[model samples]
Target chain A: MIKKFTSALNLKSGHVDLSHGGGGRAMTQLIDELFIKHFDNDLLRQHNDQALFSVPAGRLAISTDGHVISPLFFPGGDIGSLAVHGTLNDVAMSGARPLYLAAGFILEEGLPLADLERIVISMAAASKAAGTPIVTGDTKVVERGKGDGVFITTTGVGIVPEGVNISGNRASPGCAILISGSIGDHGVAIMAGRENLQFETSIVSDSAALHGLVADLVAVAPAAIRCLRDPTRGGLATTLNELAKQSGVGMAIAEDRIPVKAQVKAACEILGLDPLYVANEGKLVCVCEASAAETLLAVMQQHPLGRDAAIIGEVIDDPHGFVQMATTFGGRRIVDWPVGEQLPRIC
Target chain B: MIKKFTSALNLKSGHVDLSHGGGGRAMTQLIDELFIKHFDNDLLRQHNDQALFSVPAGRLAISTDGHVISPLFFPGGDIGSLAVHGTLNDVAMSGARPLYLAAGFILEEGLPLADLERIVISMAAASKAAGTPIVTGDTKVVERGKGDGVFITTTGVGIVPEGVNISGNRASPGCAILISGSIGDHGVAIMAGRENLQFETSIVSDSAALHGLVADLVAVAPAAIRCLRDPTRGGLATTLNELAKQSGVGMAIAEDRIPVKAQVKAACEILGLDPLYVANEGKLVCVCEASAAETLLAVMQQHPLGRDAAIIGEVIDDPHGFVQMATTFGGRRIVDWPVGEQLPRIC
Candidate 1:
């Protein structure tokens, strides 16, 4: 049956029309040929509206993210990978190991089947690499001119391990802050692609699944870790501000220690954007006890995804709960949250 | 802080811009004054990327649905209620009691704040009424001309009680098929609103949450019920065909026994559309043992959402798995799945 449907689909040249998402034979064919073929799993084989499974006994963490990145395809990643990585990272930020994902796609009429297939393949690869299968999904099509190419919304569920309690409000005075790697790669890559901007060096998006890295960190120091956050949409500055406000603590970061690629810094300068506010898909900000900062940094630096991990700052006591950064030239300034978004649809 | 942010929002006159979904202060303001204000709960107040909660030990069912209904507002319900009901029904089809919902919104720039507020209020009301709180959500904005007004994708998680094993493939040769109520109201309401068509009587959508009704039916015949499906996008004909194929059996329906409202029938006739293929937001098709069919129908009819419930069909042994219907005109015909959607974006 699957072979018959696959043969009917002109995978190389056909385009998605209204019928592909019409909840009829065309829609079923597309799911069977494209989605089910790539994201095959036991639970999804049931072909039910929902997936039924057993969850381990523990606190569960569920997160949702909508990916509307334009151009669908980027240098190192596309909207598909970003959708999977973003939601999985969100679930990971809660100090949990992501278990499964549910994807919802809103496709525009007349989209090329080739492009959609590529995106689905990428999503399946990301899910497979992360060990989290996309167990269920729904698709809807809008008329031409009413929608962009494709907008994917992914929701993930994870199980929080015992003895692990992480939240934004767990940051406290004297806690050390660490960043996984250099930032601004993802934002700069997306901006360059959307605006057709060229640079000396092409900056690829840092989009990746971080659950494995997070698990490694938690294993080393579960009790010492205070909080874990992925600096995504609002970037490092806004993330720190949120943490400070939630924890009622001030933050002081040294600019020289924060990791930022030279090319990325140059690109942000050319675009007149602050790297502090640029998004990073594969980066994380870790808040932990000062005593465990060096050991945690060592463990993070050994991981492939966190080679450039650095201890960037420390928490402090301040009534205003301000996030201040020490400039490279010995100046200090408040790294406040941007009033408006510096980049929209970068994810 | 929340009060200060609320004062800053001109809720009556403001329009959403790209910044509102930019994950910055503007986005935070919108969330604080609008979404958080209405869907206020302790889990959301934590303001973490993911919500953490405890679930009972049992089989878990997770479902996702993307709602792209045209004309954000219709005669009976808006996109918000439809989003909630659609996801909840999908979970309930697995005989699960839905517990939590996660919403992700893709908003087009320049959408009126007032309209967004109304939609959010409706979602909150629906969630509250259904006893399912939307624990976490994400919002992203697309540039004007890149998206329609607003598209919402909701994912729900539920727990299936012990001794209940419901699936589409569980239907057997002797099972009887039942429908909850009149069909085609939702699709007709949407089509009329989009095309500016009028009828003698207003055709309002039957968009509603049916988990309570499903629970009532499940309680009466837990073991006797074979399968449950809500005829949403492809309506009764498509739904029956899907069930037949899944169960590897044939279905025979009496068209006259299927309930269709007078206004809905008239509207479909004028539009040259079939009621069997039109969408229904708040209806279900149940396949149960013949012995329990009468009892299930009685229980369903007592519920407000299923007052017009009727036994319309039965499953039969056939290798071909065809769905044949006895037409009102006394002719028998194969009720095949539509090749394409009759009404696009009808939810």
Candidate 2:
């Protein structure tokens, strides 16, 4: 931490009050003592509403994500770390190296100050670990009943290196689809935390920043890679559907080749949910040319974050643009978007 | 509207559900039918997770703001337009020309689809009026009780012209302080709307984008201007206090010279609020050299947003860095940050 100002927050046993967001001395104390204390960088210490920086010569990619995950503290990661990972991954999916991030927080009145500090500490840690700092941010407060404990919105700015082009529309009929790792870990962990379900084995959320892995992939096959996406919210099935629709192509995914942890599979079976539709925070789905599949998968597995990477699907020519999956049971089914009973606030 | 995908939304009677944020077909429909339809442009049509655009080679200023204002619809401005204007102004405060914006929305489940559409339309209009488009966005839905109706967080990026530098710590003793227009319009309007107070004259929010006026000011006195800030939540009093503390200087202002509309002043009197400490969304304070004061004021007054512009005060040397106001009654008093009863969610 830069330690621009000493801690003046009553973090031991204090709760957030209306005045803390009143834009008065109280708000200043909270920001200086808490936010600036943790996210202290030269850009943030200027104490301006905006942060100024330089952008390299290249196309700029901008992305944003709103995280309202329930159970602020989850198994493998909390909302704080999840917020950083989610937005960073979004920017990275564009084949751009995330440069900086800006966060907007809405805190519910009466939220414990200790909890807020913990979240900030964890968020700062995640940012530092990812090498992307939270440069500028805003804080707002709503009445106790009007908001949950905390909702974080992160916006990221990134720069694509020269000669790199990535877009959903870039995917064609003869592309191969690959995933970074196992699916449904993040969603299952949050579900277990919220339901207080005791599993035979611990299932942790796979919430990690993927920009480093994305950087490596871009270096190896910058031209062959067509589109990149993180299977979050509605998970892998929905992600493929989005790409298929955008590219005006259909997909043929083999279920047996898809990677899924044994623990996550068991949990989904017990909960009567489809792992294909459950969210994953750390993993990524890449649609690339046929020539890049083998090289990309090898390069991806070389990275620790993508050790279990697999080539699970391929793009096919179909006017309807459907995503069909060959199940392990020797049956084929159209993998459509999830409709009902979908989890909310699962990030 | 680009009309990429025609409106498939059940706008008359539908309510938002978890599926809208579930990364499923519903979410796509909501995004394409509403957000894309209104915010359609070449960049947004890419349908990628992130928006990629060319940025000029220059300094970049980035900012983020979370809008949780009560009464989603206010008299003069709603939360939608306010979200865009507030963030653009923040970037403009740094003497930058805003280029693009990214929005993240947190919507409460069970909220009316009609209301969401209305807000999005208004937000699109605001972005269009300012010539800054919403290039990228994300939406998340929380349970009904966990969130209010809706909260929008907007992040903006702008390019600063060469040789123009603005910062909070640049103010100095003997500097001139000027304001764009009347204060307290936004706060008073919100208070009246919330309290259901029937005043003789209706007070409307002064919520407008200030980048055009900022551009003019920068063109006229780029190097002479020390710092620029919009008096938003803590109003002008807290803003001056912030500048004083930041620049390591004190301020002496003439209360009689600060422009406050007669209707807003009356409304404040009835509400026992100090117009000086009330919020103004569209107004801004500029600190510049004494030599540039007259020219800057003349340039500002030529703009519609600064028709009521005035030179209110000047920086004074004080070791304690206190802000003192010369009251209309010919006595000086310390202008301190408001301590309590701050109208929450004033945005």
Candidate 3:
């Protein structure tokens, strides 16, 4: 017989006060409606203070991310869904099967209860869709004016299949570089939502979990794939530069080969930002042997999340560790790391 | 052969701007001097874009914590150490062997480089002592005034021994309760350090890792132990109340049996605060079978970190799940959950 300890809560129209984050009845209600509803699974349904589960035999990959972006509700998603996707993508970058997550929230005093519920619901939905459950969590409240609305920190655990030796340093010369989707969508979307940067057109953030796409790629070209990286905060340019430095190689690309949506490109130009440096939360950079590049690209394109996949560049042995792209005008220039953050509070 | 990457930074000491948190030379230097230097380990030295390590085969427990304590540096430890200890304790509470950690930093613009260095050193020391290393991390900087000086979020992963089942809901009727060391030391220590309090006393915050003591308890009384909890934010009274609610049981605690240091008790009395609601970073609450209570108490007292350990309470089946304490005057009163945060950022 199943015994339900906590009752369902009416989360709509509720405003979160200091008490909500205070580990009392208010917290229990929030967990029941917003967290448990979406992440509902046997492990979480147990209602124990901690989640207990067994891991199948394999190497494990664990990653954590904290989401404190201002304006809890953004164009694409709220802090809740972002928390699930951020850590899930982190584990997925290791070519692993993300299984479970632990979340800790530091909610500021006086945040509307409705907003918290909305965020939590979104998080639950995201976790459910991604096949990961938030089994254990903690809630803490900070004094009024001492914190932003709410900050969520998520820790994810995943299992990597045996014999999958993948790392940023594993990229070898002649490996093909492919991007899962268009660049700069997430950063531009967030900036557009900001009051100061309100633009004419709406641009939603490309925030998502990429484990499914990764699992598909690994199935087809496991040995050929050298590395996988989700181009986040610093974007594709910074990611490629880091990979170049790590692998002791250089990268050459044709500007025409990279995919950039028209709206994103125009937004970047208007804001004086390079599309390459802007973030891409849903997109991933995969480095694979040239022999298996087409197979991986085909698999990525078949997935709805990776429909805009493109073969962007190729790796080359270069001690200088340069990342260069050829312009449509037939000229070439070095793509250096961005001097500073392109957009702040972009996950 | 070993390689060294150290340089004298050109920027002035106290003038950090938006670019410092950018993933570039300044950020690299900040990580190299402040974070990497203190959190040095072979896994971090891999210098790959991510940290990779081997996990032993076993059940796993994972936890994450976001440290947003104001005045980044506190009485006994700063946000760095607090971040490490907070998550590590969460993992240890599951009766697991804590192994690795990942840290994320949200740095506000204009934070002094020197201060970051101090916090990083504290984190390094805490990790070294706990036998866990921060293997991977991400850093972001918010504009000045938009955020406090620094916020640290740490995530930890651990391996649970087979057949070890420890949880908050495991408390049963006739279970004995044990507390580690003096309570309210951390809360009072911070209160004394506050400029508004203006009370001068020699009460240092009890901010130490409890995994060592947990290992000791598990060694001698593994099967008898039901639950282990760190009395952190809402302190002993709140923690006991949570246990009671989770386990659907009532608790009877002796007020005189609960250990409180002279300084903490005096400070609480002077401030019109209850030491029961005050925080204690280094202390923990253990629940076990009543028959093995004496043996567990003896084992806890033998450890340096648990010298003041005492059996403070017992569990009873109750419909209302009340936590009542017997006063020294032979009167019994209900200890209710705290309504609001008594002292913010006391952790």
Candidate 4:
């Protein structure tokens, strides 16, 4: 009955009603036709409310993230893909190979069924690309106005290989700072698309999972890499400030060396915003030994996702724990923590 | 600096503002005075933006929850305690011993410092009660109108012991069903206290961490226990239906055997709600072998949190996955999965 309804139903254009989230025939059809169809995997095939699986040998790292981004569907990605990538990256940041994921959804009443299907399909695509299957999950509905369109919370489990020691607190003096690509694209894109804030030129969000890129870096420069961070909510400035406090160290960056697209810079200028503090979905900030800087850069550049990799700065010893950047015009100033949120729901 | 401001801040009768969520002097003051003071611990003592810790050997279970209740402070528990307890119980439901928690706060602009302090203190109290320390956390602020006062997200990690296999799919025919205590307290309390809903009777939410109760149960009835679940959002009826489907079995329950307070029954009757489908913050549903039912009930009844524990039903072989309840009047009817969300955002 469920298979028949889902197969014949127009999943994309339909809106969800009270019955969709009620755990009755409507919900069963939605799950069987939409969620189960897209998120198909061996573990999910068991049809159990909870998933059971074995882990690989080594130290394990676990991380969970909740996705409450407004406009659930965005240019580069939607809430579904972001949930998978955000959590997978968090677990991978610990130098772990992400093994599996569990997703929990809180759907607002009256959400479009088509939108839900789109998001779930995207999630399935991202998981397959990243080679991690979503093993278990839950779904519940909140009344309209009580919740945003949809909120997804994903939990990830992974195993770190032997002899790998990576932490935000591990950055030290003499470590070189490298960024995977241009920053602020995600923040600008979301802002422009959301508030209808326009720019002379259009830009897209940089939301992608960087675990594969991190794996490549670790395979070659494991010992040289002291720390890795995704410049997310607080963007580059906030992330660096966090790293400084974590390692009890200071940092010095050349503004000209940091990668920022001209369009994004222009958008920030027009909106009276700071690109340095903007969010980036796909980029990473790497802290590695100065000696292996070039080698690491070379490796990162070879990957399609890291073609714009650049040496943005270097670690420094400062008892005051400040992060300073030399301006492109040769003026120096402190790049402190953000005074307030740059974009409220950028994530 | 942060310590002084947090101590003086009153969460009750206060509103949030821009500075509270910002990372400026005011934000620092808020963190130092409120969050740091209530969440004092060695890991948090380091005062880094993120926390680092080590875990003991065993398979790990991780869960995360976001609390955005309408009223920040509610009867029996506030958002702060709910944030901690919700995630801790989620981890515990997997039969794991919860170890640590990480919290993230999203304070709206114009929120009072005192209100923040109260919530933080409550969070501290709940964490301490569960014997778990909040190791790391992040804070961000949004504009006043953009947010609904305050939102909290907590992530929890726990270690599962070896040789213990428990899941929703483990239910078998002839298995006995037991409930920890009374139900519908949380849902009814929230409803009565709601701004628009006015009711004469008073009820308190049963918000609590169940790790202690679980520890006692594990000590005596580990092997016989087939499934353990916390009836939160969809309440007992939804949870039972899920178990039946997952375990590929049927259930026979006694409506009179299920515990429901008079006030709760009245509230449900007036509102045309079913008490069985109402949420319970501090209750759990346990399914175990018939032989271990008495032992588990005795162990549960001895605990203060489980004083009203009772055997409500038994598992039966039925591929149709029906959950039938025999009423006090000797009539039997299907107690199916809920038709809709009885009370949204009850979690």
Best by DockQ: 1
Candidate 3 residue pairs that clash: A14-A113, A14-A114, A15-A113, A16-A112, A16-A113
Misplaced by over 4 Å in model 3 are A1-14, A24-29, A41-50, B1-12, B47-50
Worst 10 residues of 2 chain B by lDDT: B1-10
What are the per-model DockQ values? 0.75, 0.62, 0.42, 0.25
**Candidate 2 clashing pairs?**
none
Instruction: Give lDDT tens digits, candidate 3, residues A298-327.
Output: 999999998999999999887888889998
TM-score of each prediction: 0.98, 0.97, 0.94, 0.89
Comparing 1 and 3 by lDDT, which wins? 1
Winner by TM-score between candidate 4 and candidate 2: 2
**Tens digit per residue, CA lDDT, model 4, B175-213:** 999999998999888888788877877789999999889
- For model 2, what is the alpha-carbon lDDT of residue A188? 92
Q: Give the whole-model CA lDDT for all candidates, comma-separated.
A: 0.90, 0.91, 0.80, 0.78
Cand 4, B chain, TM? 0.93
* Tens digit of per-residue lDDT, candidate 2, span B70-161: 88999898999999999999999999999999999999999999999999999999999999999999989888899999999999999998
Where is model 4 more than 4 Å wrong at Cα?
A1-10, A17-33, A42-59, A138-140, A200-202, B1-14, B17-36, B42-57, B104-113, B137-147
